[model samples]
Target: MELRKSGSAVWSPASDWRRGSTVRWLLLSVGLGWISLFDSTLWSQTKEVVLPRGTDVSVMKKDILLFEKILDVKLSHIPNAMLAVVDRTKGVYLKGYGIVLTFLVNINRVVITTPFGERPVGKRQTAEEKRRRIHEIREMLIQALKDNPGSFKQLTPSDAVVIVAHFEDSNELDDAKRHKTIVLKVFKRDLDVYKTNGYEKFKQQVVIDEY
Candidate 1:
């Protein structure tokens, strides 16, 4: 994956996900009327394309990479997160999202980082505290299961369609070793239920027929 200073560079997923890319792209298409002020009428000739909804979907798979330079650690391990992209026909645009997570421990503390639009916990936390936080996160997953089985909750925007991913840590020693466990769960959308609840609870109804 390409890495650059935050604002100077934007992330874009590789053309294909099989080779392992963590980048994603967010595009904004402008209107023809506003093009003149920027410099040129770039989009003046743009035309919208319409396709049947739910007709576009592609599967993505990738392995995680550990960035030594970024973390400043002797050793680093990366955990993989599932990636998927769905094409919506209503808009004349395409968007991408990717998720990743990692666990590390240094002399002062243990840290767990998730890129699923969820923020990592700050502050120096004891190894035990970190484990507890993971437990709580697991509970939230359980609650989501209880709320709706066979249905995916968009834990983050990066995770398109249903969500699929797993995390594992094996650190038994007190020195640089803090976690030893594995947790994984994948879920797909329950179109039937989503269509049902979308209207009542979410206040926005998904037109199944559109897809």
Candidate 2:
């Protein structure tokens, strides 16, 4: 995975999640496009929280790394990949297995027939357009996952949440399920539920199609 220096980097799933609360806050800030305002002092102030008696941090980290590798191979064509680890015993943890971007732009070449002749035109989607499209993509992916139970067959107790982000394509939802890199898919509405209703309620509503 390629790593960038200006707050946008291809973070390994293992190392990214192991940094504790401060890293979580940083990731949240990054997701919200607030990376510029991230406080470095919070790193020193952050404390590691203890897990349950049976939760093995090392094992979890190793599993996450393996999952990252699988996702990297499966979604190699996509430029951005994000993982969310949902533990039945523990809570959900979000990480980036590969390159993930705050902004997405879709550029494509299309044949446009003008008044005189037909020629290929390159079209670039604006940030707002891309954002709306991505939102729809997330919803489609979640619906696809809900419809296919076989996609999540590999998930065990150790494996929790696994998600990836990419532009909306007709074949991508099916391709991800066939690749088996993700266990559960969540959309923006689900995240709202997670924040407002709480984790248990979030899990209950995760698999339900909101479209």
Candidate 3:
């Protein structure tokens, strides 16, 4: 059996929150839009757009690059072709209501091999090791977002910055417990508290929906 290092779970938003939301969150569903992040005339097409006033397009580009680099470090240890795209990094804000930032990552591995194209000879990996690896990756993602909190300040207590890490699942597990993907999400109201509270604190408030 092959082993991977991504935590498995889904995020659940409150019923009232969804019903009361004014912004159209297109990226919440599986089959959603993949709008590229850039300065374009597209923003002018709609009165409601992702980038708000004072949003620096250049800084956002750097943030995307930083996200890619962070993912590379985690997957590079074992030669792997991993993809992390910011296809749907959108935001919506309401003056009195709140703001929301949605980020999606596609962690689909193309090839697994060394820089020299040689598979490393190692012993079988255990479940514990895999969980630990996944946890590290999750933390890196959260930290990266925290570091480059561009318009994240606009988010209020009701607002949130959502990050969804989707891992492509190969049908290698037992038929009784097979999954097509592994999703790990980070949902927090206050970014400042993340540093002092730690992962365990955040996990306490996490609402997970497992299949």
Best by lDDT: 3
Backbone clashes in candidate 3 total 0
TM-score for every candidate vs. truth?
A: 0.23, 0.27, 0.39
The residue-by-residue lDDT of candidate 3 on 62-137, one tens digit each, is 5445555554554454323333332344444434443333343323333346778944333334556445544655
**Clashes per candidate, residues 3 or more apart or on different chains:** 1, 2, 0
Q: What would the per-residue lDDT of candidate 1 be over residues 98-138, giving only the tens digit for each residue?
A: 22223322322224446765443334546676466545444
lDDT of each: 0.31, 0.40, 0.45
lDDT score of model 3? 0.45
Ranking by TM-score: 3, 2, 1
> Model 2 over residues 38-146: C-alpha lDDT tens digits?
5444554454555445444565555445544443343333333321111111222433221111112221213345798966443444546445644544554444334
Cα lDDT, model 1, residue 72: 20
Which parts of model 2 have CA positions greater than 4 angstroms off?
1-120, 166-211
**TM-score of candidate 2 to 2 decimals:** 0.27
TM-score of 1: 0.23
RMSD (Cα, Å) for all candidates, in order, is 28.9, 28.2, 28.9
